[model samples]
Target chain A: MSSPAQQSAGKPVAFVSAQALRARMHDAVNDPHLRQSFRGAMDFLMAKRAAQFPDQGELDSLRSLSESIRQYSLSKLPDLLEQLEANLTRNGVQVHWAETPEEANAIMLGIAQRHAARLIVKGKSMVSEEIEFNHAMEAAGVGALESDMGEYIVQLAGEKPSHIIMPAIHQTKQQIAKLFAEHIPGVDYTDNVDALIQIGRRVLREKFEVADIGLSGVNFAVAETGTLCLVENEGNGRMCTTVPKVHIAITGIEKVVEKLEHVAPLFSILTRSATGQAVSTYFNMISGPRRGEDKDGPEEVHLVLLDNGRSQAYADEQLRKTLQCIRCGACMNHCPVYTRIGGHAYGTTYPGPIGKIISPHMMGLEQTHLLPTASSLCGACGEVCPVKIPIPELLIRLRGEANSAPHANPAMVGQGAAYDPKISLLWKLWARLYARPATYRAFTWLATRFRALTPTQQSGWTAARTPLKPASRRLRDMVKDRR
Target chain B: MSSPSHGANTPRTYPSRPQAVYFYGTCLVDMFVPEAGMDAITLLEREGIRVIFPDNQTCCGQPAFTSGFPDEARRVVEAQLDLFPGNHPIVVPSGSCAGMIRWHWEKVCAGDPALKARAEAISARTYELAEFLLHVLGFNRKDEGPATTVTLHTSCSARREMGTHLVGRELLARLGNVTLAHHDHESECCGFGGTFSLKHPDVSTAMVSDKVASLKATGASQLVTADCGCMLNITQRAAREDQDAGRACASLPGEHLATFLLRRTGGSPCGDQK
Candidate 1:
């Protein structure tokens, strides 16, 4: 990934600071229209979440069960991949296992060449963004148009996604109107949200009809039945997978599940966690391409399982839970920091708590060291997590792991470790003095003798705020006096 | 003074409160902000509570735990457990240290079954100073602290793990002299994450800068906090800025909750709360 500075310019996310983000959110939250859209959506999902379990006990049980399922799936990933391939092949769908993005891109280009594909209508997929599939496909003389409304707006604006669910969340309707005018020529620009949605639908509907091939992302792939699942509200995923003669689905290997039963629990957790909705509008389960009396489906189906450092993640027990992520983007929503800066500032395909942990491992730790330290180690991510992955704990663990690793940014190791005791001992005497209350009291009395001599910002603590002066009498002395 | 309250009359709840609670007068209160300890004791006593000052109650092993010395942290936590025996809740004024004790006690005491039980018992009862004030002691502070406007910084450990942000707001509202205003990023850490300042000073300093910016945004004249670690951090930064500019900004440097209460009682919380 490029530097944060570069990505942020293209994205131009307004709320990069936690304070700024909170201020903007507070302002926008009170606006009637935005509140109806944002909070109404959140309330609907939160209600769905509450309805699923009825009580905290059921939620806890579900979290534990889902977590164990993910653990088991990750443990048997290698076996499951082989099983999924065989089952997919038996069902007449081609299965391609890609070790990296380069390999995945190569396979995609080969497939496109064999079929003489020209224009590809694509569904919105973080996995596709992860591999920069559009850039690769375009480089190979194929045009890729995003069919998701939020995604199309971002694509037209020439920027990466600012939010996982709401790709263009940072953009105001007015800014989008300008973007549509500048990019979608001869179109009358209207800042109305409904008008914008209609415009997006008109553009993608045409692209969907003429697309040589349909490209999509699988939300979950069942190993037992070789079925690929795609869940979305817009129905663009349906069009992307069925309207074309050849349908190609690309997803990470971790997206594979051993059985259909495993898919439901995850879906139950993901939909509510992602949108606070009980379930998405559409949950398409595709076994293979058009066969027998199928009314409207693709002629050929292909499933590409991209590794891209996923296999390496399974090797380390501390990092395996990362694969359990359902890509709900709930962590980003509640994250005080991410809400401020938005996703683009992280400069990774994945952003927020999960991004911070996975990005360093995938993109080489040195380049992404700053990512882990960006957090305040707040446990909000872990609390709202449907699967109950200890994200904050994992992020801290990653920091420890990063310390020992060899990386491109060697200078940062020293810069980051400035708080280590080897640097300074500002509280040395204070620490020793507080070892016993008697001594601590005596020291306080003596310090009180010179209470006026206290320096406001004595040492390293001076970097933050003005120090309050110490009290003249100790609490123990006050207790004794009361007695 | 060990209380006689440890007899069999009390039935044990899943979260059983100890007969005699030991107030771990953390380093900040024992020295810099001692009056905070007095306020805690008064609040606890008012609720039919018997308090014990564990003179041996040193630091919450935060310095050692945060410094990556698990063994040393264990030693400190072990000493703390010894100081306050039985199932008594260990309450302290500083949310940061209370969190370190409540959260890290198990991790430090892992493997030894006996130590684990003792640690878990303590962890269950370990409450940050104000959480006990609002939740356990239940003494509403609505009548304290003069009506001076102030911003509250939700220390990282306190707000994230202990969930004390609203509790602080609730108690601060009770104070007579204080009108609590929300900081722009009140929930963000003030950047004094234990040894974070020493180990990653550049990042720590940058974080502190943001924290300072957040505090400034509140436009309040004073910054009040439950964590002394944060108070120290904000104090240090404010002083540095004051020194650099050669002028005192409108903001009051750093004042702990105890000092606020003490000053309120003394009829001048804004300047000499302690």
Candidate 2:
């Protein structure tokens, strides 16, 4: 097996220009195997989700209720956070606030050092991935292991999770069999999925017993009952939180709700939309540490509330909808652009449609401006969204923000990072021609009169298709000359 | 109706067919595909409706609006807002442009406080041509020519914003002698997302390549759609020059639904067309 420092090899995508993003996209598109894999997978996911929503009326009502709940909860976020803190503290759980990844990592490391932790086992947590938690732990000479089967495969390969829900979805079973043979003892090379999974489970099972601390991600944090809810199909999430002496949970600030009742509808829709499952196998609700003869639970519990640009997204009225996501991967499964490029090409913690809108808040627009422009405004993300985020509308708004002249009081973190005066001037010039009826008419008339001069090779348009040409007469001229 | 409520069963109530309707010929039809606009007008006029083609109309501000240039989009859409002053229904031949005018005009006008109400009023009466034909004109296409099969491509905007994919299919179902071939992923986009094709050519090309493959797999002799943007994108990808075909070699001719419907009902210019 690999050493501890080398094992926690999670990489954050560098801030690259649009040209670099285009290069990555180009490579991904040209990879025929990658394209076919994504096409088949997305088609399968789309059909499954469609089958689950057989009754449109039921789906519509549930979605509306969910949207209302998320919006209402976010509207009273400050109050809910305070209430949640008070209740958690009373329950003997420690709560810490973090405004950045550095603060979040420092707080976690401090918690680990207090216990003199040698090893930390993790449940599947994308928030931890967002903060690069494993890398931080290894840097401090402590080993961090992923207990979930999918996360284990990704961690063994030294790669980030391509899909949040299915971390190792991008890998083939043959590749995984090879990984197990090389990384685990006495494991023969076999493409059988069951055998491969058993080998991984055996390794993780041993790690769970001797690990000094456990870490997890929160799906919903209810204020009224001081509960942290984690949803998963596998039982590893339960093992990670219960088997160790200490448990630490991290989540974005937007995951809190005012009441335990609000979780019912959100969970109902989230599982169905995410993987077409009516319910996950485990819905772990941890109230606090073990006390008063509670023998199976952890002795100490800690919760880290992460801000990490969520406040920036919440500052703007229109941009606030980005926080409404329940982390369902339905948008990525439905997006045509995402279907072609897959997840790794995005080079962000979150990938596909949800990632495009949210990554800008976490990483400034200077690094992620090209992400919004990647979509075709197909509205598939917005259409399938359980909370109705209106993703395409947000894409248009972000594009405007990226190009507009910077204001003294900007709403976004990296606003105007993509502003180019030449393109701005061209749009302004094009507007002048279009907004004036006489000018547009004359321009079209001249172009049609000299239709033969139309170029056979226009820019990117002519790459895959024939050239576009003007008709001999404009529609207005034809209608006008009709006696 | 709100934008999100454009699902297939939204219970739309259409106005009665008027004596006249304004034809908002979109820019794609104005320059590249004028025959589609002309055929649509012929179809409307055959139903005893006077088609008034506004002389001053230009592009819907969709190009600039989606390109993140809201001010420019507002200016262009605000100008077209003045062209249609009457209370009569405004019929747009292209679903994308119609959806923009009907669903998104008021959105682009949000920056201009003065034009917001005007944009909303104009949006209220705007209707996509096929929807107008089905609900208002009650088009009963007679299939004047021979039997043929065609596949229809519905733009994402129309499918999600106006529920016109069903409208387009409903219109095709009305034709007595025509068979509508089913294509895989019919509800997906064709990648003619206005400026998206220009900015991300490689990705856009890859998307349309898949769309073309799906359309061609339908094995229909003709392909038709309600949006010119999709028609333009798909036809270009479908365009192949056969040496034997000589000057008439558009292997799979992707055309406007308006033109296809007109040919089936009112008779083709080249009589007895496929």
Best by TM-score: 2
Measured over the true interface residues after superposition, the C-alpha RMSD of each candidate is 8.3, 1.6
Report the C-alpha lDDT of model 2 over B71-116, residue by residue, as the tens digit. 9998899889878878889999887888799878888877666787
Q: Across residues A1-483, which tens digit of lDDT does each residue of candidate 2 receive? A: 553335444442222443377888999999998888888888888888888899998998888899999999999999999999999998888999999988999999999999999899999999998888888888787888988888888888877788888888888888899888887768799999988888788888888999999999999999998999999988999998899999999999999998999999999899999988888899999999999888688999999999999999998888998999999899999989888888888888898999989989998888888889998898888888999899998999899989998878888877998999999999999999999999999999999999999988888788777888999888887777664
Q: What is the TM-score of each predicted model, taking all chains together?
A: 0.76, 0.97
Candidate No. with top DockQ? 2
CA lDDT scores, all candidates in order: 0.69, 0.86
lDDT (C-alpha) at residue A456 in model 2 = 88
Candidate 1: tens digits of C-alpha lDDT, residues A6-90: 2223343222433132234334433445433433343444455546556666666677777777878888888888889999999
Task: Tell me how each candidate scores on DockQ against the true complex.
Answer: 0.22, 0.69
Per-residue lDDT of model 1, residues B1-274, tens digit only: 1111110111213333445688888867766666557766765665667888866666777765554345556666676677766567778888778777776778777868799787777777778877776666564544544467888887767765666767788877777667777765455556566655654454456557667777877778788888877777776776677777887553446677755654555433322432
lDDT of 1 at B8: 10
Q: Lowest summed-lDDT stretch of 10 residues in model 1 chain A? A: A1-10
Chain B structural similarity (TM-score) per candidate: 0.83, 0.92
